[model samples]
Target: MSEALLEGGTRCLRNVLGRFATGVVAVAAADPADGTRAGLVANSFCSVSLEPALVSFCVAHTSGSWPLMRGAGLLAISILGAQQRAAADRLAASGTDKFHGLPWISSPGGAPVLEGSLAWLECTVEAEHPAGDHTIVVARVRALDAIADGEPLLFYRGTFGGFSR
Candidate 1:
């Protein structure tokens, strides 16, 4: 494709991808020393392995929490349920007490596992690659749990919804 076409193609791709629904997840981490921690809602997560246990998520290069989470040594991937959109929004906010009024349980690795999620997966960053305006983070799952029975929160066309069947 020509350069002009490539730019237009990217825009088209973005619009096309928006039509596909995705599950929401929160990638959280804690600093064991000072107990400082943070998390953010992400619709860009997926399982990558099972034998060695691994998963991956993408974060915008400009995210402030990415630096903190990278330094924490471990991250908690909290798969949000359809009812946890508020939790997602809270985490997605910047420069705020993201954990305020949030209910969570502590993992063995000291990460916060938010309650009422479809599941929680604890991981340690194994690899990070710069991908355009985002960073692709590959983590090795350290600990996890399918803690609840519920439908996932879905993101599509800039809105939240859930499966009907």
Candidate 2:
């Protein structure tokens, strides 16, 4: 395959995949000792197993927040609601404090659970595997709860929106 062909193929793959809409989430954690926090927005969250209460999300290898959150031992996954688009944008941005103006409460395990999220899951990293440009994180759900009732924030075709009945 020629270089131009490979580049075009990669873009095509991304465009094709973007056709599938997905819900957005904030994957975050706080250092128990210092209360430092790290987080990022991800639309790739998924359930892996029910028997072990496992969930998974992908983080890009270049993500600055992942390294900080990874060492926290505990992580929180907050399901973003349709009204939380600003929060999502902040978390997805680079080189800034993701939680600076975001309201959140710490989970029992010291993970930051964003307030106003539709639901939240407290988890611990069970395993990680490198996949191309991203790392797949499998987590064991220690605890979880639905916090609010609302439409989920979604991403489709490179844009974000809410579902309609």
Model 1 poorest 10 in a row by lDDT: 1-10
Model 2: how far is 75 from its true place, Å? 0.3
lDDT of 2 by residue, 21-96 (tens): 9999999999878989999999999999999999999999999999989888999999999999999999999999
| lDDT leader | 2
Return the top candidate by TM-score: 2
Superposed on all Cα atoms, model 1 deviates from the true structure by an RMSD in Å of 1.9
TM-score of every model?
0.92, 0.94
Show the lowest summed lDDT stretch of 10 residues, model 2.
1-10
Residue pairs clashing, model 1: none
